[model samples]
Target: MSDLDLGVIGNCAVAALVDRDARVVWYCLPRFDGDPVFHALLGAPKDAPDDGVFAIELEDHVHSEQHYIENTAVLVTELHGRQGSLRITDFAPRFVWRDRLFYPQALVRRLTPISGSPRIKIRLRPRFEYGSVAPARTYGSHHIRYVGPQTTMRLTTDATIDFIRDETFFNLSAPLDLFLGPDETLQLGVKETADRLEERTLVYWRTWTHRLATPFEWQDAVIRAAITLKLCTYEPTGAIVAALTTSIPESPGTQRNWDYRFCWLRDAYFVVRALNRLAAVRKMENYFRWLMNIVASLHENDIQPVYGIGLENKLIEREIPDLPGYRGMGPVRVGNQAYEHLQYDNYGNVILGVAQMFLDRRLLSPPNRADFQHLEALGRRALKFYDQPDAGMWEYRTRASVHTTSSLMCWAAADRLARIALHIGETQRASEWRASADRIREVILERSWSKKRQAFVDSFEGEYLDAGVLLMTEVDFIDPRDPRMVSTVKQLEKVLGRGPHMMRYEAADDFGAPGTAFNTCSFWRIDALARMGRVEEAREYFSELLKLRNRLGMMSEDVDTKSGEMWGNYPQTYSLVGIVNCAVRLSRPWEAII
Candidate 1:
């Protein structure tokens, strides 16, 4: 069974997950959401034989250790054996080539001897159509091409091909470079090419991370989270996926699996916002271009909660029955059905995503009056649905309700629009928006708050508590220290807190109650506690939460709070964003340390 104990390597366009033993377990071809080429993470059960993995097994190996190169996507894994130890270096080549950024759909693995002579066997299996068909392969002296119906990849290696082809153990004496990418022959020596790419990629990542305005504390944690979030971005179209793999069950033995490769409007908003906090402005600008496309594609003012990275609209949901899911949980899914559902909070999220365009003068393109007009149209849509029922931010598939978070976001939409209008000299429009925002706020306070509970409820006049209600303080919908906000934080912590983590909500949904704690919600709780002036307490929980990350400092969507194991999707953008937000919020300024 596959687990979240994986390190991520990518160049923003394509990402692959490698397990602790250095098996390239989950890798999608062509793009982030494409066919799974390295599908060992969801391989067929032991009863049925399948080939969808790339692994290097060292004979007599006893233990292994893995970590990412500091502040970079490059991963290093060490395999210890009785005879010797070997080091495997993995990364996707991404650096400035010519004048354009050259981030190909490729992963390069470099293996070298660390100590004595160790024998190793290489297994390269590339599958297609979600692991239903194994690709036919044709080999050259230096490379092997795995040809599938939809895609083909060539693995160029410096190692002897016979050993790889026959899966025979070979004595390791020197380093070998394996480049798996587009079906093309290598122009340069595979060793030289791999080394150059590694050098340049390392330089590229370190250069990128060097520019970040990180906080004084938790610098390493913040950098790792930022890099993880950056890896989730689909650069060609500026769409940030929620997570890399799909149908990783939120909790063991639960069918709450759903595809998360698409660009969730809400998730992308938080992703860009978090990156922006680190002064990684390019991601937000690239994302703004993507968001503008969605805004332009509006028909009848229809808004979707998610879209494909290339802005493809119809995300028809279905299952890939051929491959078992994470931990043999079946029904591995593709295409999220949320695109067809109305998650009303997206209107607010969309506006919030681009609102920075108007305020930040450093961007290549600043918002003009014309842009304000486009945003005003979006504001109209928000007011129209502020009180209407729809699938809230959680995308609760079974029911639609007037969720409090939806209202808070709609209120945020009006409030931000009012602020933008004032900045752009549209005083009349500003006043109108301010009035609209005030009205929405009044309604939320009246309907969402429960006198008996002394805290806000999930939906209007509802009796249940929800961690999402904590968003009220996040968007400035409510003062952080307001009595109601304080009570809401305390109430949510009492109901949803799971040790150091927090569940998304207390109420059960379509799949029944959530078994694992939502990682993002836990981070939000830290922010809320800090905002309420409980810095020491919040810091304690934050430190404990950070410990939940895997060995490589990577987090998933949810956590098995009972066992302190990670669950749900790996490298979740929402959970990562919480790291940035909380770190930035709680970190003392650099001047203080200085």
Candidate 2:
């Protein structure tokens, strides 16, 4: 009976999700794709003592409220009991230290009594290797160390150790501080350190949000979405995760969940594009370095659709059978299978992700001819695979067909390469790439378009309607105002649109037809609607779609149109980025506001 009523706190190195009652339910140790140290979000077995959680439970708890501390990743939760009330402040410290970015792999919590005498229990359960190992514990006067085979975690706190260890409620007279992170002694007292880190982290986040060039309208919502998007970034490697937790189902009573901790090449681009719209250049630059490392490491033209944050290419798909999933949906997967699939659109996405680096004068390191040469290799692969496909962007498990989205991305790769070549004064190379782009575009227009149905279908020589065809205008493959493009949008609306939602597609895939509407696709629908001169309707749907975000202005991968419950991975980057993009497209100009 668990829900997605969670708020996230992070420092780009590690993140944790805090449930409504201020329990740290989901936390990964050391890094984003690392072991789940606090795994209660994906619960343990039925009647298994509810392991993998760090909870501060108020005795006789009646109701609670949770929210972020304005324009920051810091979260505050209030618990009200019959006797008294207390406030819980949670955040992972992030700030500049020693003239460098200091984001440790840690989470900090502060408990302050608000009213009359309040008693609370501390439940700190740290699991290892996906809930297979329960670590042995050792304690000092002020800290407890959890030692396991894979990792050792420490909790340094000012609270009573016996009360925490024995799960007994204790009277709260003064504020308490708990710092859970690597097994290390605090340089200072827990209270002073937590307070200092909280203040620094607050300043850091406010400064970060202050710099964002958000649209005047929906300023608060846009800022929250942008901050969440920033939290999903693994700063050391510049890899942005699709979501924080794994195995959150796409809908109720379904096994449609997959681990989303890894960085997908396609998804990373969209995230970068969204941040770039707000003039946030650090993520783009760091991600460009990450992207170049991946490109440089490829001995051949081969690239994966997803990889570990550190750029490790081998992401073998597997399931941890022992760990029960979100709300007891089992089969908690670790690695992703999409890494093995040939998602052709990734080629274009890669080039598009870094294409601006060549032209943006603000970049510290600009692309040189050598980089273009390597990209030419990718363009050749694009040309070779534009008309062929192994998996579409949706990652169909059992089928492989020539998808229109694949061809469009390949065309995008060539098209961007041509522009890059022109910018670098390589007319000959530009002409060649332009020709490649033109040839690919012709085939896409010829094979993907359906004459009888008057719309572009999902695959070549196929009559199935899909929301993916709406990307034709997104990548500039077709004008949004074109008659053919207009008809395709109309057809998709009839076939896939549900109220303000839009399904990924109507046709059955390896997992039968999708039930929850893909939230990202619905944003894509808004863009199409606006571009096709349906501005008022587009604005209305955009406003409606904003309601699907959780109380913290966070979104997921999919949403049930009828019930309005968000599903899929929590705080999905695809859905979050859609908010920024749609806002930019639909917002009134700054000139008008000024």
Candidate 3:
């Protein structure tokens, strides 16, 4: 496998690539949500003729293998070469102190050559604000300052190294140190030393991972998925972003690119469920608290389907005229404008996540209780728009249709509200919500189902089947054995199922062109199959889907089966959650399928 080709774009939130030699060749400092500090992944360098964008040459041609550390947000990459072997573990630790709360930093890169001497090349080049600004460097004994507007990166090294202004490089034959300081200055002796830093980082990670309540059989996958989900979270706001990077085309250069750095209300239920399963009560509680704050911030008449890191409802979608997209996909976009569109499913997700918390009797923080009340009021307000025509979950481009998925979400919201009210002893209000849920359920069965097709349609009026309907089984909208459920699964297999995997739907009918199959939907199909008592088929498909993960056991948003190349964003949280959920389900007894 000498011809092994391995490259990754942290297009989602954290766009960085670690080579086979265990070097992070490209990385955008600060945060994944921040602009690229390394633009090599998007395009070639122009300003620095001799110095390339960012490159790291390993000490030896080591055989490298990589994977995320189980149940924590750390990445471990091991390299074994003719000379010797070494392991490099990388992670951006969660901020613990209030003073360091907003610090967007990553640490802990230990390079210990086990046996033979190996030479390593070190290079540091940072392009600030998505390559829009290049900072001036000032070299010091232990650090180099790259200063830009409102952003400064102090690169510190432990060993005496040559400062390369334009393509300056050096060979390391002994132990060395490298530190990345973001928006902060470094005082060689004042700043934490390499040995102390490594010890603290390891302890931080070990302490956090020790908190997890491991489940039977599938602990490794669950822990990794949970950690990935946590890494995607914006700690300050308690908002979990959909993904880290954006504009990684579903196809090589197609226009299907989108930014996924912002939090989506639709992901609320899934995130809470995943965290709750792992016994991370604090994480789940923080999410609800955040949602409450968002709800309170909304006006009686203003409700957005998504929100920014600060819970701001406004997000203007626009293309960057300068920066070329990942792999040359044009029109790189920032800030999603889908907030204005009506995605009715969000109401359901919010209610479900909050209700889960309520069920646990987790008292809302005193300051956030008012926000929960506001959320309840907003639920009432959403009822007015529930029956209105708007964009569906897929965020389709055409005119609004009564999306089956949206209607299902409406049912979920009402059902959750009814349960919450009942749990809190609000008998009268609970009855009203229950009645509303029943009506929505009736409409879904009556209008969304196609008798001729014997399956649920994507919309109340359309004839197409949607993969999202798979969630019906997940939310208890219908029993897995229900005739309607079986029929919908079969219909989805016919229209959306591609071999062992499932597509979001017929691409030609919805997006006007065919594209890579969505990886998460395929896992959902596996979950649905397992729920329907097709254990043998589910296990077979599950095994096959697991094979699709990249060499590092990481998955992107989509996959091109023919060439077997991952498409869309790398390290997709949704895809990882799907893996965790399915793995846990498959590991359980038949009676415990739920």
Candidate 4:
């Protein structure tokens, strides 16, 4: 059975998920949205034995352990067998070279002997078109070429070619180097280039890590979460993906699987906000450019919830019929259909993402009048549909209601725009935006509240509770101490809360009732509890949630509270942000130490 314990390595240009046994279970080519050349992560038991894996196995393998190299994205896995122990250092080359950041579409794996003589087997399986087809291969003196339908990758190695081709055991007396990358020949000896790349990559990561302003406590956990979030970013266009690989079901046998490779505007505010807290604004600065480009392409009242990394629209969600999903869950999906859903919260998200540029002087360059003009356009749409019905943040298909969360986001959009306008010294515009926000808030307060239930509900005149309403205080739509908020939190606890874990909502959706707890929502509950002066209780609950993370200190989108198994996509940006936010909020002030 799969434990979902995986280590990720990437150069921001490309990334791979290495399981505990050091197999490259998941890696896309060219870019995060590109096809999967190694699709073992989604392979089913019915598929060919080596249908979708790239692994280096020690003969008679017994056990293994994996961890990142301190603060870097590099992963080191140790495999022990009856014969001896082997160490594999894996990383996608990322570092400063030639006075600029160089992130190549290459994965470098170096294997070394750690003990008595150990024999190993090299298994290379590359699939194409979402694992629906296998690629043909041809070998050379020192490399092998995998010819796929749309791409070709060369595997250059320093190990014996015959052993690799024959899949036979080979004695490990010295280190072996393998580089899987573009079809280009190496200029230097394998060991020399690998050594320089490894050293430079280490320096680059350490330098990057040194700049982070993490909390005094939980520094290691925060650093790992930050690095994982950074890896999910596609550098070319500055779009941060929600997660690396997609289609990992939220729970077993559930159709809740969706691709998260594309950038969601809903994620922009949180992503930038979390990074800004780290005092690392480079990613936010770069992402602002991507957001601006998306803004430029938007017509009046036409903002989307998601877009391609390069701002390419029309991500048609479809199923790959051939390949079975992770752990034999069917309907492997490519692209995302959420693009077509009318997620009105997107308007507010866009404004929030860019509003900071107007106020934060720490950025290298701040937004100008033209940027404000573009933001005003989004604000206009938010004002237009604050009370209108569409898919909520959960992307609920076959459902359309005047979702209070969506409407509250509209209020947030107006509120932030008012602040931005005031900052730019446009008093008239600021007052107008403030009035708009006030109107939306009034409507939300009047209608979203349920007199019968003695709490605010999911929508107008509704009785069912929604976990998303928990964000009202966090987003500043309502005060934490407000009687309605207090009552609502109590109502949410009674209905949606499962011990410390909380479900996004208890209502049945496209799928049946959600069995897995949405991890980020639980964190939101912690935040809510702390803000409500329940610090001791919040701390207790937060500690329990921390234990749910895998051995690698990473989390996915959802978890089965009953079994404590992480499900959904790995290295989830939302879940990682929870760690950073909770740590920052819960950590004692520096003055306490001083």
Q: Against the true structure, what is each candidate's TM-score?
A: 0.98, 0.98, 0.89, 0.98
Arranged by lDDT, best first: 2, 1, 4, 3
| Candidate 2 residue lDDT tens string, 344-440 | 8889999999898888898887879999998888989999999986789999988999999988999999999999999999999999999999999
What is the lDDT of every predicted structure here?
0.89, 0.89, 0.67, 0.88
**Cα shift from native, residue 18, model 4 (Å):** 0.4
44-104 per-residue lDDT for model 3 (tens digits):
3445422224444455564677765544445566666666655665554343455553234
> Model 4 — TM-score against the truth?
0.98
Global local distance difference test of model 2? 0.89
lDDT of 1 by residue, 1-594 (tens): 678889999999899999999999999989999998888887663434557788999999999999989989999999999988999999998899899999999999999999999899999978888877778889899999999998989999989998898999999999998999998877899999998999999999999999999999999999999999999999898889999989988888798788889899889888888998999999888998888888877856578899999899999999887887777887788998899998888889999988888889889866678777877888899999999999898889889999999988999999999999898888999999999999999999999999988899999999899999877777878788999989888888788887778888878899888889999889888988888899998999999998988888889898888788888888899998998999999998998878
Q: What is the Å distance of residue 9 in model 1 from its true position? A: 0.2
Weakest 10 consecutive residues of candidate 3 by summed lDDT = 1-10
Stretches of model 1 off by over 4 angstroms after superposition: 45-50
Minimal lDDT window, size 10, model 2: 41-50
Look at candidate 3 and tell me the lDDT of residue 45. Answer: 44
Q: Candidate 1: global Cα-lDDT? A: 0.89
